[model samples]
Target: MTEQISVLEKKIEEVTKRISDLKDIDSIRNLHHTYGYYFDACLFNEVVDLYAEDSEVRFMGGIFKGKESVRRFFCDRLRMRHSNGHNGPIYGFLLDHIMMQDVITISEDGKTARGRYRTFMQAGRHELAEGLTRQWWEGGVYENTYVNEDGLWKFKILDYRGLWHADFNTGWAHTPPNLYPFFSDTYPNDPIGPDEILDIVPKPVLWPDTGVLPFHYPHPVTGDEWDQNKDLNTSK
Candidate 1:
């Protein structure tokens, strides 16, 4: 009878741990998805609040280190450019970032987690806007890390690799190279630039050049890294 009770207790403990891990995964997913909604509405300050104080951002070959620097990139730079320094969506601008396909992995201790998500973005200025009226389709990948702050999870590292972009009318097949230029200048000097410029090898390209953004995790079943040379091609 005592042996049976011990077995049952062990089984209960195992179940509890599994439940905890699943909760962590869900929390992390919700955190990221919330960020997407905030970003889509151009809530720059709110987006920055989702990050840890020591968090960093890697975007378009530029490394914006620390929460303050990330603030400069998103709040100061992006807000001015997109919404004319407004906190919410503007009348003539449309920037919708749809984040999905999250593969989240929680640490054994549950203090940290890693996730990979894909973002499909549609951004442009409407004819009512004061700027050039153009619409575009953009796809990117986010290989990010999260840290559990007390009980809440926050972004520790946000590394977004914009793979390809195309004009709404032209599409990917007719897209030109370097549609969106990477940061060539650093911060302080450029006012709204990144803290550091990463020298990426095999430099990332745009459509019609199909460059595969490397995956953060290995294959779940096979446990093998993706082949970078597998079927990717460049435009003529």
Candidate 2:
């Protein structure tokens, strides 16, 4: 009878752990979704808040490291480009980040996780705006890492690979190659540049070019890792 009780207790502990992992997965998913919404609205301050103090962001082959550097990238550079230096939403501007198809993996310790998601973005500025009023379609993949900080989840690394871009009316088939260029210069030198320009192998490209943003998780069934030796373009 005592042996049976011990077996049952062990099973109960295993069941509790499984439940905790499932909850962690869902929380990580929600965290990324919230980031998408904040990004779409150009909520730079809020977006920065979602990241951990020691976090880093990888975008367009540039690495924005640390909280201050991340703030400069989003609050200064991106805000200036999208919202005319405003920290919040603006008039006659639309940037909707539709985040979906998320795959989240939690660590055994339950303190860290990795997630991959597809982001379909629609960005445009109405004619009322000062600069060129144009609309575009952007597809990207985010292979982000997260951490549980005192029971709150925050982004440890926000890595985004923008694969393709096309004019809203023209569509992707007629899209031009290298529509968006990667940063060639570092911060302070470029003023609104990345802290460090990464030496990404094979380089990243936009539209018209084929690329594969490597998966963060191993194959679920096969448990095989992606081979990175092949010349795989990091761009769309």
Candidate 3:
């Protein structure tokens, strides 16, 4: 009877481990999708909520820290480009696809986890720069780290390394007369000319400078050194 009881306990342990593993997998998967949703929707607040309050995010050749800085990076720099009327209309839809590859480790202590994923994003423009309409594609890999605190999983770091990027627009459409006035006098298209007849519109800036955070750059904008010790806390 004692042997039988021991066997039963072992079975229970195995089952518990499996359940824990599954939960960790799901959490990592959800994190990937959550990033895509907030990014595509331009929901800066929601994006900030996904990370730890003191998390770090490094992407597009730059690093940022804290939930506030992450929020500013997305909302102020990335999203701000749409505020202007030049690049394209803001009502268009964008689709992001993130393919998770593997979960490297789901810590038994429940304090940390790591994973890898690939992403592909496509933005479709219905009305951009007058009658000009097109699509843009960008793809990359994400190296992610998460931390469990207060029974919740929060992103600690996300490193995005670009793989490929290209735009579908070939400039086939000519600039429409109504849209011509919107363009600056020295617009690039003015000298380049157009191939086909279409409405012309001003180009929008897709990138902007987000405010910097300590530990993000070695030197702050004021030409002062950032906190050196903060580097040790980052995921690296």
Who wins the TM-score comparison? 2
Local distance difference test, candidate 1: 0.89
Q: Write the per-residue lDDT of candidate 1 for residues 1-236, one digit (tens) a residue.
A: 99999999999998998999999999999999999999999999999999999999998888999999999989999999999999989899999989989999888888999999999999999988977889999999999999999999999999998888888997888777777788899989989899999876566666666566678788989999988766666656
Order the candidates by TM-score, highest first.
Answer: 2, 1, 3
Using all chains and alpha carbons, the TM-scores for the candidates as numbered come to: 0.91, 0.93, 0.61
**Model 2 alpha-carbon miss at residue 123, Å:** 1.0
What are the Cα lDDT values of the candidates?
0.89, 0.89, 0.57
Mind sharing the TM-score for model 2? 0.93
Question: Could you tell me the TM-score of candidate 1?
Answer: 0.91
- The digit string of per-residue lDDT tens for model 3 on 89-143 reads 2465454555655445677765788777767677665664433466766566777
Name the regions of candidate 2 deviating beyond 4 angstroms: 231-236
RMSD of each: 2.1, 2.0, 15.1
Task: Assess the local accuracy of residue 34 in candidate 1 as a C-alpha lDDT between 0 and 100.
Answer: 94
Residue 125's lDDT within candidate 1 is 99
Query: Which should have the higher lDDT, number 1 or number 3?
Result: 1
Can you write out model 2's per-residue Cα lDDT over 72-153, one digit (the tens) per residue?
9898889999999987889989999899999998888989999999999999999997777999999999999999999999
